[model samples]
Target: MIQNGFMTLWKSSIAFFSLLLLGNLTGFAQQSIDVDSLEQVYLQGNFAPADSLELLDLLSVTFQDPQKVIYYSETLIQVAQRQDSTQRLFQGYLQKGNGYARLGNQVDALNNYFEAANYSDESGSDSALGSVYVTIADTYSMNKNNDNARDYYHQGIALLRETDDSLSLSTGLSNAGDFYYGLGQLDSALIYFEEAGPIFEALEFRIGIGYYLGSLGMVYGAQDKPEQALEKLNECLEILEAEGDYYGVAAFLPFISDIYEKQGKYRLAVQYSERSLDIATTYGLKEQIRDANLQLSELYEQLGDPGKSLKYFRQYATYKDSLSNIGLVQQMARLRTNFEVNQKQSEVNLLEKEAEISELRQKRQDAALYVALGIVILAFMLAYGLFRRYKYIQRTRDVIEKEKARSDDLLKNILPEETADELKEYGRVQAKKFESVSVMFADFVGFTHYSEKMSPEDLVKTVDYYFSCFDQAAENHGVEKIKTMGDCYMCAAGLPFPEKDHAIQMVRLACDIIDIVSGDGYSEVTGFEIRIGIHSGPVVAGVVGTKKFAYDIWGDTVNIASRMESGSQAGRINISESTYLLIKDHFECEFRGMVQVKNKGMMKMYFVKRTLQGAEEVLLNKTTETGE
Candidate 1:
């Protein structure tokens, strides 16, 4: 319901409070150590490297000035490197990235973020890596790179949820909601926002609650529930203002402007827009400044104030250009970082060899003293070794990915995707009874007698060929191929999961099987013909056994399907009355009146012909004839 036609409000969604719940630790430390006192101690050079890094980390996020944050972050990095603290190094790079992001240098921001990821990986901390992903997602979202934002958001959430970092998980959820909110996906936005709210409440994080409520409010406003929206927004504003989050306050006020703008209240809209502009300018929130300016420009134009509109429009244009995407720069940075990360990795092998070679050279130094020759030879050996290693790693990765894909395909071949997922996730698949499903059975007319005359290879090849085509036919019509018993192929539609058109799918699959064996010169080449039978009724379906479990169906429906196939003539698809009724309008069928079926006594049967193909085909034919 949140249409893109409305004023963009604050282009940046997600409050600082909700952006990094991990940074709340830094926030807490800053509170305990007064800024003025910390600044005096830091300036006096009285603190140890650890204390200095800690102070710098606190000060980096404390200031609203991006330049100051960047300055502090660089110092933090130096001290952290001196101490060999991987966690500190990650934090330093992260804070630097945040600074660049605030200054609207997206390329530099992304580069720093990727650099932070190196240290996060080095630390092998899920929480740290998750935080990095969330931060990168925020940057991507700010620049309107939605696909990257969505990918990172999911990645961050996946990792964070696996750890004990509730705050990080909640923040990821809230930020993801904000990303969806920006894209005007209100329902998805609401889902994440609702999920995050309870987590923040349980943690008693007031600022998190404020931001969570604010996003929830924005989603509601977009949904056209003004009263509910205003209530939450007002509550959010109160908490944020109390916490003195100037950027947060500035970023959200324009949302109020948006509601007013949509309501056609130009004066009220302009008032909230001006309020946001004032706060953004004071706090140096560039994105919010741009957004508020743009909002004001449109509101003024709505009110016929051309002079004010033009002035604000120019400001909007200036900030927009500065904040625009630098995709090429980012791509180059990404490539450079990827190469560096690969070289530094433990699995690279070359680095370990270099270290070993260095130790060997040191031991031989006194005996040979061929330093320059050794250097040249070592360089040549390393270059060749590294080249080979890189090629090996690339090939290995390609092989692994291909094998993984093949393994997945093989698993899907053996079982339904949903069932496979369940089996993998829980180590078992539960049997379920379907109220209505379409079971199908197809059999080669005389496989046993023909196999006695044919060679073993020829028999196997013919069975494989027919079965392969049958598999494709089943897949095409969304039917599940349960198994093949010698000459008989058993399948079912709507067993693992219920589908509305299971009967239709089963019938189409049966016809396709008939076509494959009878119509494709297959009979002439292989001397084989098939009969297919379909019945629609209730059945139990699942994977059973342990050593060589198979996905199979049971009950009277399957038995009747087998009977139908056994009684059917070559080159024909036989169907029970249950299936015939479901496909009556879709395909042409010949009613055989009543027939004696074993165990079931008497049942109405039908023989299927070419597809009537349902109402869609009729409509297409009519349209083609009239050219309308």
Candidate 2:
């Protein structure tokens, strides 16, 4: 079982890498052109420079055929050299680099990228140069050359910062975050993710937001914060669902399933894993398919379903062998070797270029070299300015963190912890039904007359004082304080997670609220008494309203609980018959017979006097005896 669990986690992480890399590549290829249309245009005689550039652009973004990409890029270079167009020449070399990189020819890819870089530099196109630098950085990162990768990443980021290109900047930040995350530097990873999140949100880029949230979820999962992981992942799932991004949805589902499995929710785990497998199969996401099979296999093993587990394990083995046959390992080894070779060749090329520049300098004695040197110095100064700007942004992030915490605190006060997290993540919450829940309501008796006698501030303060106490009491008993309306306070137990002793817990909380409102200090100061009620049944809870969010419950159970409070007298706790049965053994109660409830008709009621003399000790002893 432990081996199966480890395999599940390993496969899921592989799926995450595949999804993240695919997302980055898609972002890099922002604009796609129709290959067929471009091919038709290229076939016509007397093609213009724009036509050749368009064909190269189309081929660069096309990954289905690397050979076709190489062919078209080579053709574009010939045309560009004939026209003597530096811009088109840069495009040709860049497309060739992309093509070779796709074919696992890193040596050729790096050479083409460097050639493109020179042309871009000659043309003074910072945008083109920044792009080339990013590609080179990506290649170095792929080859595990961390130092070279970091240097190129810094250079690329500095160049793009000057252009004010938010798209490239966010992508760069996300890539850097991935780098840190791979190294288990979670703090650095979070900083980059936080910086990129706002940019994606501002742009309303759903795919980018999905990727960011997914990455954040994985980091949280690695840190063993399952609740936080679920929150972020569920939000990512919602976005992908809305955008009809089946591949993204498939990638995230297995992680969520693993979280549920860790939480001991086997039913939910199986549900999510099956969903992931279904979507992955439909979309032909091979990595996700393998991950889902492995996850489901482990989940079923945990659930004691050996037959299903064996079936999925067989499927997992089949796909594992097929993927191995695809030579992913060999390709990686070759890429690293090619990168080393290319690095040496690049140094030799740079020396030859310097020798040519020296000969030209001796022949002409022009100021061009001096101007070039000055530009290099200016670029360094600009890079430094950007670095300082980044530092300022980091400082600004610290302030934002404080504000975000404040807002989160305020939100938690208004909603349950789990519900608040869901709202913050998805911007909405769906109503969910709890099978068995205990609902409680407390209302101040005769508050209308007291309010008329006192000033508005005094009445407000009085209510706040009592409700604050009620809040603490509810929290102490492990209950959800749903909301307070007017003179009434509402709370519940046994959801978002169900509890077997929900009724007992709610009764305890109800007693605590009654004590607070009826105590001598409160009665003398505010001249206020409160009636409390408790009922146990089912209820549906969710957040309502877009502008002013409120976590509330609706159902017959809630209505009955409310009716119990309104029908009871001051300074007493009333409960319905259903709740009475659950707590009768733990508390002393008096039968009130049938009471006339508004919409509930005749319902049996009981007055909970107090805990039986030995009941508290019995409860504590039972808990201790059970090792609960």
Candidate 3:
């Protein structure tokens, strides 16, 4: 897979080489020419030098034939030389360079670009000079001389800043982005591409958007973000397809295919690769054809179709050989050797100029150096102070975060998790009514009497020990422990977060609490018993209070549950009629005759002994197990 991915990248790079030249043809649609009329005027030998120059520029770009471009450019150069028109000469040389570059003749292309630079320098046309510098940088980039490429790119941008040429500036930024992208400097590439995106959009340049977004998509894909890549690439593909730019569409298809393949969408990968192949074949795009074949070959292999994989691999090999015969590597090598030679000569010239300046400024150099040293020392002191301040602030932030976490944990301990979250987010919580919930109340049988006999600390510790045990039991059975009164414990099931098995869970929790208090060790240590009552009905639960927040429930259900607990005897579990209906099939119960309550009228109650074995055995064993 790694080898296949590298091959795909190489093919994409080759395909994009042609696109690099098309930047200059942005307004070609507006430059349409009547070839026959232009040729007739050129043959008549009566046109002005400016008219001749315009004709040649249009012919060079519009023909789509490299030999014709070369012919028109050479003829234009001859006419400009005869007429001593430096601007026309610069244009002719630049156009010739473009033609040679398109034909994969980088040696001649660089020579013509340098010739154009000489004429542009002599004429002092900053715009023309910037354009020549951009072409030279692109050629160096193609040759992989990154240092030279970057140097010339900066020089071109510096010159372009003095001219009002937004289109050229946009193209230069995009080209610089592509150079960095090819070198795998994705962050730097993204900076340039994003800078160009707004310029292209303002100009309503669809072609520029297509290329800019495509570069962004490829960069995102290299970063292993397939979704973002698809978003950019799909937008680019839509624009290219609408404009009937089939070659541009073909160039982007392989990138989409690679993203889909990485996402494990094999069918979409194959579909895109095949579409790329069809478009490339129709348009005779050799680089795209080779890329599509390679992608399809690997995709088929992943899909476990060896026969189709082999077929596409064979086609890929044939096109790969054809691409090699185009002499791209040889051209790049020659271009690199020439660039190195020119760069060394230019460095020598710069050193000579620097020596002359050094001799002229020797007297002032010492005073300037002393002033620079003092400023540097002062700046360093300020920077050090800022750095220390930053460290102190970071430490303070860390301490604040730690304390915040501790407080949040404390708050969660006092309230239910969901209620605590809501209170923190909204500053208050609205009460919500639950149609049905299980409310359980547990009270120590002789808590008040035992407290009066023992020391205050001893009494508080003993109560804490038993309530802690109850807390654990409630948590284990998924019951919410609401709050505890002085001698009574209060809790419920199914508020804050709803649970369908609230009644069942509450029953289990009550049983666990009974077992904990009646244990041999527990009874001997504290000499206390617990009474638990559970009743199921509608209740409204919420956090109440602006300062000291408390989560509590209210309704007739709470009243009945309290009555059930108060009416119960020692060491036994009592439940109201509402809760017994919910868990009748699960536990054995004894129906206590109707009991009168203060607020609530007569209510049916039951004493829960132990869980039943089965529903049929409820009738067979009507006996209730008495507490120890």
Candidate 4:
């Protein structure tokens, strides 16, 4: 027991001394890597292997525990603050952002990149700005904010172009091309990759060239040019192999495998896919690992190896699921952040509204407090002023109202009252679909001879007197005046408002017009008489045009109505077969068999003689029986 206790005590003593020595050595190492020296060494690009190793060692010593990145960043920030060159400070921030990105702290990385970009922009350093934009784009890309990443890549490319930096431009172009490729815009992807290839080749940037070639090859494959795809992919493989870039080689192999798979070369597909997976696993490329697993899964399934297929498929699904979960987690985080941001914005808006409300309330309170005091002093002046103003306004408004009434009456005279009402309510009225309407056409018989016999003034008076009689008939029969052309008058009924007796009313109006012209009021011409026609059918009526508009009816109905008037005899009311069918039972009509109407072939015309007599006929029959 004593021996075991002594051994324990001795082990503890030795461990304590070893820790003490380690602490002393660490402190000494830290003192050697002073902030000034670090800034100077990094600025001059004089970081040798040993120098980097020493800095890394000193960092370990400074952070003796597994400290948060913020703790380490604080130390770096202090060192950066002591540096005189803005370039060094930007580099410090960029490096810090990259570290945060590696640690999956996207917000911190974004903040650092933002700061770096601001400093670079202010300093007019194109290269620095380009680097900052690239870093920011990478962060956004990691989160699959493709839109933001694409925009930042474009900005970076523009900034790099200003510096004539081929490498930065090539990188930016490659990234943009990759984004386009992912979005399935093969044309855009090809253009950007082609732009990047020349620049990368000029700079002898082997990795950039490989990436561009691979991307171009994929686009070619997507474009269904297999031969071109194989050529490009082979060239990419050659470059990747020569550069000994295992990660790049791994990446290119999968693309080559894709070409083989597309070509139905399953054996080659399996071989290349396995090789890519091995290389990727060795190099710890998670992306290549995932892709290789998926490719193998498809290859195995194609080869009909169910067991192997299932194994690879499981691996693929597992890794894919993990990646998907990670994406979902990141998406959830972003959504939570956005929700918080929205909540804060809402609160800010609410506060602003509250402030406005408070300001209004204060104004109202002040106005109320001074109301009694101001009213007594201002009453007499306001009352007299208001009275005179009111009187002037009242008189002016009365005149305006009278003028407005006159204008309204004029409008009613031009259009039907219902149409005027619609125009006023809707500001502008739409054309109505009138299912059916009554149309009438009237022309004076032998008016030309009558006009020749009279003087010019007398001729005008004679026509006016005739047209006035027709107008009165139209008004009595509830017909809307369509228009009068020379001595011919046309009127329509049932629109802009519809009526059940539209056809009957139109027939009555026609008879009235004929009767009035044939009466003793026809002294201007001894044998003066008017021929009238009426028809009823579907018509479209609408007020057309913005200025100088008129309501017009169009359809077969109106055309037939005009034909009826043209086919009428003097002093006769002619109607088409359709009109005769509707009004024949109500009125006495003589069927003028098969009148040749234009475009109507042979139409049965009727001469509307007069309305039927029921009560008079019954009375006459009873009297005849009684007398007999």
Candidate 5:
């Protein structure tokens, strides 16, 4: 069976953007390149600016050795920097990233890509930005972060779409197809490659056209259309071989072999696999070598050639172990540590030599030495005082910054931004009497008994879950949440800033609050319901305490709201007469008659049935498909 073997590695390093960057350059990149000849020419250093960049671009894309690619890319970067060529600089960094990506050094690869991104951004060329993003998408794709890969691909393609750069846009499209191809979405993969096909053909970009054909071939192979698959694969293989892309040739040979193997043509599969292995081995393409060996081993086993299977399996294992970058990582770590140790030793030796020179000078002239020593002492004391002052200033600024951040966080989290700003300016919040304000209270029905059945952790989680929903409902309807006391949630509107439709807003919020607990899964979730209440009247609102500040209201409105909640039935919204009168036009309410409250005597209350058709709608996360 076909697998995601070195397809990821192949796409990550030698994908369309690799050549896309080269082809877009205004030099010899559009022509066929003899990379060995170019390398020979580069070895005989110091050419004209244009010629050097052109040669480097061609060699960067054609080089089979990743280490050599990196070395040349560094030289390219220096040349670009000296010439102040943004385009060439971008290509240099991108080539370095591609080399690292090929070597499985993702950290360094991403670092170089981001460095290229900075240049791309500064260049303000959408095509440049798109190319880098596509490169980044390849790296992320190879890493199997599918979500980030898709996002980056979309960003790259979108940006490329806005530019007149057909070549770069085609690169983004085909690579995106490769992304979906790896994900096994054959149809999606085909669509992208097809979309990119005409662009490549129009530009006469042979490499791009080959990749497009190859991608389509793979999709057809996966779909079991062997005739079409073989035709496309063979056509693309010819193009790659002609272009001297040995890496692509080695990578695509296995795809052709997979198609033959799936068709039960064992001999043809073996021939193709061997061909891939030979080329991969010749070019030192480690990933392709391992993949080809494994493919042959599996094919041999299927053909009943146990001896060949065992031999190829051993070879595969050997390459797999040898190809791991772990030892390389450790070697780098060792080099870094040794460099640091040597640096410290050099510093120590320099200090010792300075001390010896000072001693000799002191022995030569005692009076002159004393005078110099006194000057040094005075300078040292002055430096010490200045250093202390600097330290003190820095410490004070740090403390102020930290305290300011903490205070800002506390203020914004606990209170509203406007309220926080007012408190900051005045150092105290004055109680303001709002003529009309709507207050709401929602309590979980039978929560006390529910808590008894659940563990302490589960109990808190349950309460928090329901209360959080209530808070969201309140916030969505322009209701300001005051606080939550255990299972009860309190909020108000028209107080922090007066809203004319506070009563209507609160009623809609109450309906949403009921909706949260009225779901079909509600009984299974908590085995309980919620009771909501609303009232409207004058209320004095302000921050109450100095240490533990609370923005609370003190009036009959708050009391009535609490009484309404207490008098409410399970899964119902109870409203005081004052609230009903204000919201009657907006909501349907059932008269519940005058109910006697504990301390406040009898009060007229009504149950809010549902909101009117033209009224404000509830916006809770628990809102259903039916719009209930």
Candidate 6:
């Protein structure tokens, strides 16, 4: 085992060493070709010139190598078309558009960004649309078209509500704020800057927060509050210092110098202005350095140094015009040429391709006709076979419907309508303990004697008649029949759904039973008077079984209720004190105090007096307690 383990370890070590060697060799091969080109541009702070041009040249060269560009663009489009996600499609268009934009193709970039917006709209991806909107807005801003830039900025803000991307929203807000500041709308600029500030703070976007604060400070400076402006601008510097954001520090310093210039502190302004120029030059920010030089020129003039002011002013103008020629206007002209060329070529190619493709399809159509005919015949045979299967399924469905109806009827008989609904929805009913549910147990007095006297047929007939009367009485009183055991009838109120007037319902059910039995329908047959016992207390009721299910009540309340029924006189609804308390006010009930009957130490009872006036009084009897 030790030898085998050693051998395995040696093999693993050899494999790892071989993989490392291969990776190192590949890395070296890549390093040998143009590695320093991108690296030097990034490391030497040459992003404004070389890095931008390199990216543009790379995209232009790769476009003719269609295999290279097509992998990214075509794959993105294919996935976007196949999937239902519009956001993903939007991202694909955004990336493709960015590729075109990098090659100085603004027209294609604009078209693709609009396409992204459409996809994002369909997908409800407001955040993704916000990104595309920001890009379009920034392009317009860079071209100095402030009106179009501000319009797109508001549209992006509207889209930002649907997305929780604080970083992106803050960036867009900061840009819009700066644009407003440049247009001299100081108050509107402050509002945008402040709005963006909190979002950056919440997201912990340190760089974005610093920029918004600096922009806000610039707005305050314009509004003539140098002290307030200085506070915000200094805080901006503190954040940049802490974050070591040299790029941000370069951008913000010139604005801080303006705040000093506004406070009549020309010396301090000149000092800060020189520092801003140093940082901007260090970071290769030529545009920011030009702004700093202009500030310094004004500061020198304020300090009574016209000679130095003129020198710096000349430097500022030279840098400004250089930036305009090489940076903004030149890029715009390149974009215009690319746009016109692509637009004309694409339209011409599309029209030519459509006309040329309409001819070779006629010969192929003649051959496909025979194949289509054969396929139609095969489809008919398959459809007829499916029809026979459908008929057999219909017969099975009829049997299922009948069984379902039978089950529904069984459930309705066993449970209350509401209780049945709850059981179906939740799959089971929770057992509840009712402290004052009225239970009524009725029995045919001398039922055993009557059974002995009558023939079997006559006894069954009499019992059936008695049961039917009991069921009707229970139904009329809104009580549930528990079940009939031999000659005794059991019913309950205040469950399975509880009611405040359960005792009343029970009393009515008991009285109805009595009235029904003594009526002319059964008076000629010589039936025995019924005895009823009512009790109120806590009882646990629940459905218990895996296969054969039934709802049952348990505990001492049930037992005491049965005892009350056994001890009661014929034609009386005898109830306990608990039941009496609930229903006594509603009915003419006579108290039967302290009855000594069963295991219960002692219990108060009541006699329910039958009201003769009207159905209203009898209905009130349903509320009376029969004390036992």
lDDT of 1 by residue, 15-82 (tens): 33345444444563354456677677889988885577678888876765678889988998988998
Which whole-number lDDT from 0 to 100 does residue 27 have in model 3?
A: 29
RMSD (CA, Å), each prediction: 25.5, 31.0, 24.6, 28.2, 23.9, 20.6
- Across residues 20-88, which tens digit of lDDT does each residue of candidate 3 receive? 443345324543466657667777866885687677666655554556777888988997888888987
Instruction: Give the clashing pairs for model 1.
Output: none
Candidate 3 residue pairs in clash (backbone atoms < 3 Å): none
Each prediction's whole-model lDDT (CA): 0.79, 0.76, 0.78, 0.69, 0.79, 0.67
TM-score of 1: 0.50
Summarize candidate 6's per-residue lDDT along 120-143 as a digit string, tens digits. Answer: 777777776786687676555545
After superposition, candidate 1 runs with Cα above 4 Å error? 1-9, 13-25, 28-33, 318-628
TM-score of 5: 0.49
In model 6, the Cα lDDT at residue 54 comes to 39
User: What TM-score does prediction 4 earn?
Assistant: 0.40
lDDT at residue 572 of model 1 (Cα atoms): 87
Model 5, 202-308: lDDT tens per residue? Answer: 99988778888888888888798999999998999999789766766887787788888888898998899899899988988887787788788788888888778
Better of 2 and 3 by lDDT: 3
The reply for model 3, stretches above 4 Å from the true place, is 2-23, 26-50, 326-628
Model 2 lDDT at residue 500: 95
Winner on lDDT between 1 and 2 is: 1
lDDT of 4 by residue, 1-628 (tens): 1123222222222222111221222232344445545545645768774354345334433332223333444455555566544654565465556455534467887898798787788789897788578667766765668799788878887888888667766766666676666566878877888898898789776656776777778788768888898898888888867755564577667666766777888888789889988987886655456667767866887888876866675565555556457675454444444545698876666677679989999999999879966886699779999999999999999999999999899888778888888887887877777887888889877777877788998777878887887778788768899878888888998887788768877887776676677678746555677888888889887787677866677888888899999999898889887787777656778988988888889888899765436424433653575593
Residue 57 Cα positional deviation in candidate 3, in Å, after optimal superposition:
1.3
